[model samples]
Target: MNKLLLTLGFVLIPLLVIFALFMTNSVETQITLMCVALVTAIIIGFKAEAFKYDYTTFLFFLYLASFLGILCLIQFLFHVL
Candidate 1:
């Protein structure tokens, strides 16, 4: 179960986010996926860890996801400019 959750978090979510970013061409869809990814990361970040090492990865994921919305805005601005 732990491995499965980790795989979904580290692999699946990013894949979906990247796929949405390039494949949709819809800014709304891109933002929604990024929001979902951020929410998932937040859930993982807040879960009580079964092991000490768990927080390490979750923290990193949270850190990265926290910037996703800002990244979306920046990319939009770049394209507009």
Candidate 2:
């Protein structure tokens, strides 16, 4: 149960932050947040030992990194084209 809660927290906290950023209705802020999330995922992926062996934890960060990568790409396309 404790592990479950911790997993939920890893998912929910970012979702909540994204929710708040969406509420602001600022594209720049959203893009910035995405970049930050992507970097954070990378840092955590390398520095966190648990991510090395824990599949669930690895998936969570992988999901975060990929999702943020997509968002950043879309934002880049929007600005360039």
Best by lDDT: 1
What lDDT is obtained when candidate 1 is compared to the true structure? 0.69
Q: Distance (Å) between predicted and true CA of 29, model 2?
A: 1.7
| Top of the candidates by TM-score | 1
Model 2 per-residue lDDT at 6: 52
TM-score of each: 0.69, 0.47
Against the reference, the lDDT scores of all candidates come to: 0.69, 0.62
Clashing pairs in model 1?
none
TM-score of 1: 0.69
lDDT of 2 by residue, 3-81 (tens): 5545554565487557635664666777766666555554545554556667887787677667676766776677678
Q: List ranges where model 2 is wrong by over 4 Å.
A: 1-8, 11-17, 35-52
* Model 2 lDDT, full chain set: 0.62
